[model samples]
Target chain A: MMDFGSFLAMGGYAAYVWPAYGAALVILLAIWIDGSRRRRAVDQALHRLEQQRNSER
Target chain B: MHRFANPGRFLRLANRIQPWLKALTVLGFIIGLYLALWGSPPDYQQGETVRIMYVHVPAAWMALFAYLLVGLASASSLIWRHPLADVAAEAMSPVGAAFTLIALITGSLWGKPMWGTYWVWDARLTSFLLLFFLYLGHMALLGAFDDRARGQRSAAVLAIVGLVNLPVIKFSVDWWNTLHQPASIVRMGGISIDSSMQWPLFAMAITFHLFMLAAVIERMRTLLLEARLRNQRLAAFERVGTQARASE
Candidate 1:
């Protein structure tokens, strides 16, 4: 049987520890994704605006 | 709010400030990480794992701080009709939700070794979880309406209502018996921790602040561009009508 102490001592509770690490990873990924999507939206909006400006001229 | 409502003006200022914000965030994170990993002594209680406080605590703080920003922005928009206040609030909502999730996850991670449980419904934890819900609610409310203005206005109201939860979350640890630890870095009685812990904590705080600034500026720039596009389309429609009348 795997001892409880041994289990926890494995990377110092890394079994439980992995969740937090995963959480942190997700948070960073969310920030990057949100920023990038917003950037893309801005680019699209600008492209449309550029087309409008030229057509009007 | 009115002062920065002009997109051209806002973009110029943001362009100048983005570089500095980037530099500050990188420098602060480096110093904070160095101090947290190497400079500080381990807790008599938590050992080296205590170092996680440097990131975990500030993120928890930012989760709350970001909402307060949303609440304030919503209030400004509702009151003064700041051109893009709702836009700002909407932009920051996802970022805030992400931070709240990080805080909850990290808190749970720290809790398992110390408290021996992966989950708890304690006051601090419960309220923080609700904080994440508030962010979701705001996001949902914003998209609920086919009319963007109507959607934005409704979300702004929801954000304002959610502001009440911030204080409840902050004081929950003190007001109730909690598995969570109390604040050591920014106590009303002054910081009770040692200098070693304090330095890294301060560094992390600065880094988080700079990170928020960079994210906000980038998001705001995107909002400005979107609004600009909208205005152009409307103007073009008006011009088309005038030419059609002239040709007739």
Candidate 2:
């Protein structure tokens, strides 16, 4: 079995391999976070509008 | 499918499926990453750089898959005037665009190490770049007008027209000489990739699709809420206008 250090080395292609995976991770997480954040913001705005309408009535 | 075209019903279904979908995504990534990083063998020629394919291939596939979806949804929106379809097409544009960006960046990264260049203006790469622009154009059209329906209708037209690029992107590698390799998994003969590599690739592909679906559902819900908010504000404005007229 390869040692821990060698595994991290990725057979000398670590620079290319790690960054590719890292880029995918970042992009995927960004979409997930951005989607949920927009959803939450819109939901909150809708809620506030409804509450204001009720109070006025 | 048409039955669920009602946004309320679709939102309820979305809410129910979300937790399960997220859990599966997390689980799939755990397994997929393990196989991709540890279990899979390095390529004989590409060496450890082949690991990039685990992420790059799935992302490229999703980029195309998402566009295909946007195209189909746009067609439905244009033909049937389904509001849900408009929301769907609009919601998926950014997701598809993000995946396309990932594919481009990672492909470039892989290209640098293997082909000794970050980019080339070959048919496959060029067509894929056009796919990214189509997504941007679709999103831009969606918000171009004050009238939401008009904006959606216009965007739907653009998206349906852009569907022509899908086949060109798919066939470009075959039809032209390019640095990008031709199809390995979906050729007429069968998948050329080894079974050992297929496990992580397929797992990551499935996980990416689930992630895309989850993101789309969330965006769809937001669009629905925004529509409701618009209607509510309009009604409130009308009420105030009526009161002002009565007092005058």
Candidate 3:
């Protein structure tokens, strides 16, 4: 097994490999977070509208 | 398929499938990353830089696959006027654009180490750049009009017209002597990749596919809800207007 340091070094191309993976992680996380936030906001708006209709009736 | 054209039924179906998709995507990423970083061996030519392929290749595949989906959705929206098709196209474009950006950035990172430069104006690179712009154009057209339906119709037309670029992006490497390497996995002769690399690549690809599906489904659900909100507000306004006129 390679040492932790060597593995992190990525065969001396650390700069290139790490950033590639990092960008993937950041972008994927952004998609998930933004999706969840939008869904929640819209769902809340819908729920409020339903309640308002019920109260008026 | 026609039955799913109803937004309510589609939303219920999406709700059922989303949990499973999210779970599988998370699991896939775990296994995929482990295999990519540890289990896979370094390339003889590219060395550890080969690791970048695991992410780059999958993102590129999704970028293309998602565009193909947008093209199909746009066609249905235009032809059959499938109610959900417009939502599908609109929701998927941003996700597709995100993947394209990832691919471009990661490809650039890989190129610097392997190809000895950050970028080159090769056919493959240039065409892929055009794909990114096509996605941006699609999204821009979606909001360009005051009438939401008109905006959607214009975006759909752009997506359908952009279908020509899909073939160009796929064939760019073969059609020109580009610095970017040609197909290794999907070529006619056979798969050039070894079993060691294949596992991680397939794992990541599947994960990305599931992620795309889940993201698009979530976006569609939110869009449907927003549409309902709009209609309700409009109805409420008309009701108040009728009461005022009735009193007068």
Evaluated with TM-score, which candidate comes out highest?
3
Cα lDDT tens digits, model 2, B1-248, are: 77898889998999999999999989989999999999999999999888899899999999999999999999988887886888999999999999999999999999998999999999999999999999999999888999988998899899999999999999898899999888887677888789989998999999898889888988999899888888888998999999999999
lDDT per residue for candidate 3 within B116-186, as digits (tens), equals: 99999999999999999999999999989999999999999999999999999888998999998888886
State each model's CA lDDT, in order.
0.80, 0.91, 0.93
In candidate 3, stretches whose alpha carbon ends up further than 4 angstroms from where it belongs are none
**What does the lDDT read for residue B106 in candidate 2?**
92
Judged by DockQ relative to the true structure, which candidate is superior, 1 or 3?
3
Relative to the unseen true structure, what is the C-alpha lDDT of residue B56 in candidate 1, on a scale of 0 to 100? 82
Kindly report which residue pairs in candidate 3 clash with one another: none
Error of 2 at B49 (Å): 0.7
Ranking by TM-score: 3, 2, 1
Q: Runs in model 2 with CA error above 4 Å?
A: none
lDDT per residue (tens digit) for residues B1-248 in model 1: 56778768888998898888888877887787778656777688886567667778888888999999999999999998887678789878887888888888787778877889867999988999999999999999888998988988899999999899988998898899998877767677887888878898888878877887788788888877777777877887898899999999
Q: What is the i-RMS of every prediction?
A: 3.4, 0.9, 0.8
Compute the TM-score of each model's chain A versus the native chain A and list the values.
0.70, 0.89, 0.89
Residue-by-residue lDDT tens digits, candidate 2, A1-57 = 778998999999888888888988998899889889988998898889889988998
How much does candidate 2 score in TM-score? 0.96
Q: Indicate the DockQ of the complex predicted as candidate 2.
A: 0.84
